[model samples]
Target chain A: MLAIFVEMFSYDFILRALIVGVLVSLCSALLGVSLVLKRYSMIGDGLSHVGFSALAFAMVLNIAPLYVAIPVVVVAAFLLLRLSENGKIRGDAAIAMISSGALALGVFAISITKGMNVDMSSYMFGSILAMDNSDVVLSICLSIMVLCLFAIFYNRIFAVTFDENFARATGINAERYNALIAFLSAVTIVLGMRMMGALLISSLIVFPPLSSMQIFKTFRNVVLSSALLSVGCFLLGLCVSYLWATPTGASVVMANILAFLFFYSIGFARDRMKG
Target chain B: MSLISCQDVTFSYEGRNVITGLNFAVDKGDYLCIVGENGSGKSTLIKGILQLKAANKGFLTLGDGLRLNEIGYLPQQTNVQKDFPASVWEVVLSGCLNALGYKPFFGKNEITRANEQMQTLHISNLRNCCYRDLSGGQQQRVLLARALCASHKLLVLDEPVTGLDPVVTMQFYHLLKEINRAQGVSIIMVTHDIKEAVSQADHILHLHNKQLYFGSVSGYMNTALGKFFSGGGQDACNLR
Candidate 1:
């Protein structure tokens, strides 16, 4: 097992994937706590679908995918935020409409262009070799920015998520902080989608916090544990994928599912003991 | 000058007036209760006072060095907070975010203030406890402490005791009364419990799509609208 680990790390592409994967996992987990608590977890799913369309359009236009995808998904995220705030359209309904529409556009683009080639499939299902040296550098810088922003505004984010009306009453710009969360999530989604695929990237933003919430009762503890759990799961999933030759995205999602179940049972047992 | 004064304020939603012709003033150290039936614009009026909503045709003045952000607010519980994983300390300390301006972390002064507020609310023992694990009454106290941490001059409570049991509700009211009397903090509370509101508050503002009465509790008891809403003349005074 130790020799196998050494061999895997020796591969340059695997190392790059691991580095970016760990960073993306950490960022998503940190933002996930706020998103899940605010009932905005679906924003991740919606944004990833938009990311798919952006990637597809980029592929058709023969441009760099990240360059096109980042701005497009960010704009879609802001539009979704505005739509939800408008109150004319319910939040879930807006997400459903936009995500499905974007998915359709992506499918349409792909069918009309290269007819679902290997590169497009990699975008859909993710490939370990998809991340280049420049991609790794970009992911590192963006991930650090996300981390620092989350840390600096941690208190305000907590206040806004816990109670927006009360936060607003105290003169905290709840909408601005909410936009910040959406913005960070958009960037994280685009960055992670390269490795986790658009279909599975949101799991990074959802599973860790939920698993930690099953046992941890306090917000600080939940956030800390969620970050640790996300990184652990990503590494574990990477190892499994390397050893078994499975898809990286599905392996990571499966690892998360297992962790969630494990924590849930522990919580259940604790409750029974108390009773 | 009054701490807050609303002059003929009219608030509209989607171009339809939800509250109209609202005129009232909250003086320093005053305890005012706002009561109204469902759709009677009590919430709209509160929003207007809090500066969450702008009035279409009236002016709202905040005098006596009271900024909109300095008003301690204990809003009604939302579903999002019911299961939130937060420590009591985190929730209470968050009230100081407005004063924290540009500082990333809470200062020692803010920390000491949060501890003091927690002590005042008698929740010092529950500082590290998870918020969701507490009883409804305890949760309200945590939120009240949070609100108190924001401002020393005034408190704005929107149906603060909606879900607690009767015993807890009375205890909560007793705590608020103590705070109001001891600290000289002005309070503007919106509640559905008219009898309790009449007894606890020094002044009453009743609304029925408009301001029906705004005066001392005694004066409100004399008005026909207050008498009817307070469940009758003699019982209202007796409760007080």
Candidate 2:
């Protein structure tokens, strides 16, 4: 295994994969803070599936999948917001619609293009072992955009996400901030799908923030710790996958979940002992 | 001058009319206590005033001279919010977010204001504590302090002392009185504690069957419903 990793880790191919994973994880971690705060944990999952479905169609139509998928997922997120506001579906019922519908659509598109260079294994789990230059660049760009958004709108986002009514009475237009969250969620989901794949992507978004909230008492702590955990998970999982030729998305997601559970359980124990 | 006035404000949800055709008003520094049976629209009326839910049929004007930002609100504590993972400082700091105009970090002035509000609410020491880890009464104090941090003019609370002890309830009332007298902030509170509502409230709104008995606290307490409705037997401090 050491020999395997030493050889692969030196190769530019593995380096690119590592870069993509780390960058995407960082962005997802930031957005995960908002998603967890807003109680829209499921939206990240829903949008990722929508991206997957759009990816298949883009492939069949011979277009760049990110272009098609990003717009469609963003629109789907907006629709989810509108539908929920109108009471079209109550309490995450819309999430079920988007997740299941998008999953089925993805499978159907894949079946139609099944013979058109179908690398089912790679798409299902993630093709980190085979990532190209553009994927690495795309991930870097998304991460930078996410950081930029955070820098610019941190206060409004904090106010709206934590206590929306307070934001509103203070004249901070919560609806706009809520829309920003949904829009950012769509973009993050699209970029994240390439690294974690549709099947395992949401784990990074959910577990990092959840675990960080365990020991940290402040919103800023939760944000910073989650990003740190995410970067660490991505680097560790990438190394393991490069060494063992494991399923890349599953390996990373499992590693993140394990790390989260470990720390969360420790925090729980410490709290109990104190009590 | 009347800072807030309502006329025939009706509100409903899912076919049940909660607060029906209510009419009332609050002058600056008036502590209005609103009471009614469960599901009789006491909370609904409060929510209506805060614009949490708009009136379906009538109007509530927060006075034309005042901007929307002047009205402050403190919602009731819910069981679900008790587990929120935020600190007392963070919670109090959230109040200034609207005033600070969306900057990432808090500057010296915002920090000063937040600290002042917490100190005024007598919870400045709890600033470093986790909001969810505090007792029920402590949580209420934290939220009240948070409200005070942003409470520029109007202070609206929905059951401000829901689960607090009797002594704490009195302290809560005293704090409101201090805020009202010092800042000249008008307050309207929704409560189930009838005797306290009658005794402390400057004005009383006894809501029943889509009608509002709008008058001075003593006037309403002298009525038959107020005499009976002030928790007739359970209450020890009966009016002469």
Q: Model 1: residues >4 Å from true position, as ranges?
A: B232-240
lDDT of 1 by residue, B1-240 (tens): 999998998888888888888889999999999998889998988887778888898888899999879999999889998889999999999999889988999999999999999999899999889899999999999999999999999999999999899999999999999999999999999998899999999999988888888999999888776777777667657766
Please give the C-alpha DockQ score of model 1. 0.87
lDDT of 2: 0.78
> Residue B121's C-alpha lDDT in candidate 1?
88
- lDDT by residue (A1-275, candidate 1, tens digit) is 89999999999999999999999999999999999998889989999999999999998999888889989999988988888778788999999999999989998998897897887778888888888999999999999999999999999999999999999998888889999999999999999997899889999999999999999988899999999999999999999999999999989999999999999999899989989
Candidate 1 docking quality: incorrect, acceptable, medium or high: high
**Tens digits of lDDT, candidate 2, A1-275:** 77876787788877887777777788788889878767778888888888888888887787877778888998998988776667746748888887899888878877876663535545656776545677667767877887798768876777677777666766777888788878877887787676578878888888888889888877778889999999898888877776677877888887888888888898899899999
- Model 1 C-alpha RMSD vs. true structure (Å) is 2.2
How accurate locally, in lDDT, is each candidate? 0.92, 0.78
Off by over 4 Å in 2: A1-10, A83-88, A116-118, A129-131, B11-20, B52-58, B102-104, B234-240
Model 2 — TM-score against the truth? 0.91
